[model samples]
Target: MKKLTLILICIASLGLASCKKDTIVQSANNLTIIKYIEANQWQSSADGFTLSASLSDNRIDDRTFEDDGILVYISRNDGNFYEQLPFVYDVQSYSYTVSKGRIDIDIQSSDFQSAIPDKPTTRTRVKIVLIESSQ
Candidate 1:
C-alpha cells in the first residue's frame, strides 16, 4: 500500500509538471485599398507621360511604407473596345512613387507606343490600384 501511494504521487507530480499554460498575442490582419484610379488617360509626350492620383485614405502615410506594405498595379486597356493590352516589348518601363497622400506614375510614351502600336494615341485607358496592409 505504501509503494502504491508513492507511485501514484510520482505520477501526479509528473502530470502536473507536464501541463503548462502560456499566453500568446496575435496581431490583427487588416488590408485596405489606399487608392483606386480608373479610366485615367494615357497621353503622349516628348519625355513620356506622367499621371498623378491622390489616395482616398491617408492613413497609410502614418505607417512605414517599406515595413508595413504597399502594392501598386497599373494596367492599360483599349478605350474604344475596353480590352486589356498585352505588353509586347521590353523597352517600356514604369516607375512610381508615393508621397504625402498622392501617388505619381511615370511612363515612357515612345516606349509605350512601340509596345502597343494598335492604340497608342488617346485611345488607351490606364488604371491604377494601390493596396496597403498593416502587419
Candidate 2:
C-alpha cells in the first residue's frame, strides 16, 4: 500500500509538471473623427441635400473594406446628443454612404422628393467612426 501511494503521487506530480498553456492575445482599434458642415456646404443632389467629406487618409484597406464597420452620426444640439443615421427627425430623413476615401451624408424630406421646410440654415456637426477589426 505504501508503494502504491508513492507511485500515484509521482504520477500526479508528473502530470501537473508536464501540463502546458498556450495563449494568444489579439487587439482591435477604432478611429473616430469629427467634421463640421456649414449650412452652405450641404450640396443639392437630385434626391435632396448632400454633405461630403474626405477621410484623413485612405485608411481603410482591403481587409477593412470587406468586413469593417463605418458609423456616421449627427449632433443637432451642439454635441449634447448625437443621432445615428439613417434617422428621421422632425420631417427630414438623414442617411449616409461610405467609400474607400470619403463619406457622403444625405438628408431628404420625409416625402422623399420634396424640399425640406427647415433646410439647414445653420452649421451642422458630424461625427464619423471607423471600426478597425482584428482577430
Candidate 3:
C-alpha cells in the first residue's frame, strides 16, 4: 500500500539519520519508566479508554522521538507480572501510543464482539520503556 510504503521509507530515513554523529544512535540504551493508573484515572476514548502519563523525566526527547522505539507493558494482578502491550488477555486488549513527552495506554475488547469497557474499576500497573539510539 502507498501508506505502508511511505511509512517504511520514513522509518528508514530516521534510522539512517540517527547513525550519524551527535545523534541518538550513539546513546542506544534503554530507559524504563513506571506509573500506576488508579481505577479512576482511565479516561474514555473512541477506541476504548486511555490513561496518559507524563514523560517528566525527559527520557524521550524531540530530536529522536520518532527514531526511538517504545514498549509498554501492563499488569493486572497476575497479568503475568507484566505482559507487553498489543497483547490480549481475558478477551481484553491492551496497547499504547507515545508522543514527545507523553504516553497513553489503551484497553478495549479484543474481538470487536463487545464495546470498549468503561474505565476499569481496579488499579493497573504499567511499565513504559524507551529504546533510544541520540542527538
Candidate with the greatest lDDT versus the true structure: 2
True-structure RMSD, every candidate = 8.1, 5.6, 14.8
Q: Taking the tens digit of each residue's C-alpha lDDT, what string does model 1 give over 28-114?
A: 554534233444433444433443333344644655444554545544433233221223325555555666555554454345555
Residue 131 in candidate 2, Cα distance off native in Å: 1.1
Q: Which candidate's TM-score is highest?
A: 2
User: By TM-score, is 2 or 3 better?
Assistant: 2
Per-residue lDDT tens digits for candidate 3, residues 1-135, read: 999999999999999988856544354677788877777666676544333333333666784477878887877752448888788777677777777777777777777666655456667878888887554
Worst 10 residues of 2 by lDDT: 48-57
Stretches of candidate 2 off by over 4 Å are 1-26, 46-57, 60-63, 77-79, 112-117
Record all residue pairs in model 1 with backbone atoms less than 3 Å apart, i.e. clashing.
none
- The model with the greater lDDT, 2 or 3, is 2
In Å, residue 99's CA in model 2 sits off its true spot by 1.0
Tens-digit lDDT string for candidate 2 (67-95): 78888898864457889989988878778
- Residue pairs with colliding backbones in model 3 are 23-134, 23-135, 24-133, 24-134, 24-135, 25-133, 25-134
Steric clash count of candidate 1: 0
In model 2, the clashing pairs are: none
